[model samples]
Target: MSTIFLAVGLVLVVEGLAYALAPSFIRRMAEELPKLADEYLRIFGVAALAVGVGLVYLAQHL
Candidate 1:
């Protein structure tokens, strides 16, 4: 559906902007990611997912 495409496009735009605007920062994060524990990363991922779902719900209702 169009909504799915739009969501993918928006994600790409935001991700692209991060790399374009702060290449070094992205690189540093990537470099340090491996040093992070699996548990912390899993928690971060779950938190991000929750926020993303909440945003989508708000956007749809509001």
Candidate 2:
């Protein structure tokens, strides 16, 4: 659907800006990611997923 494409496009734009505007910073974060524990990354991923879903719910209902 158009909504799904819009969401994907927005995500790509934000992701592109991070790399384009701060390539060095992005590389540094990528380098440090392997140093993080799996559990720590997993928890943060889950938290991000929850927040994203909550936002979509709010957008639809409110």
Name the top lDDT candidate.
Answer: 1
Q: TM-score of the candidate numbered 2?
A: 0.89
Q: Which stretches of candidate 2 lie over 4 Å from their true place?
A: none
Q: Write the per-residue lDDT of candidate 1 for residues 1-62, one digit (tens) a residue.
A: 99999999999999999999999999999999999999999999999999999999999999
TM, every model: 0.98, 0.89
Q: Mind giving the per-residue lDDT tens digits that candidate 2 earns over 1-62? A: 99999899988999999999999999999999999999999999999999999999998999
Each prediction's whole-model lDDT (CA): 0.98, 0.97
True-vs-predicted CA distance for residue 11, candidate 2, Å: 0.7
Highest TM-score: which candidate? 1
Alpha carbon deviation, residue 21, candidate 1 (Å): 0.5
Clashes of 2: 0
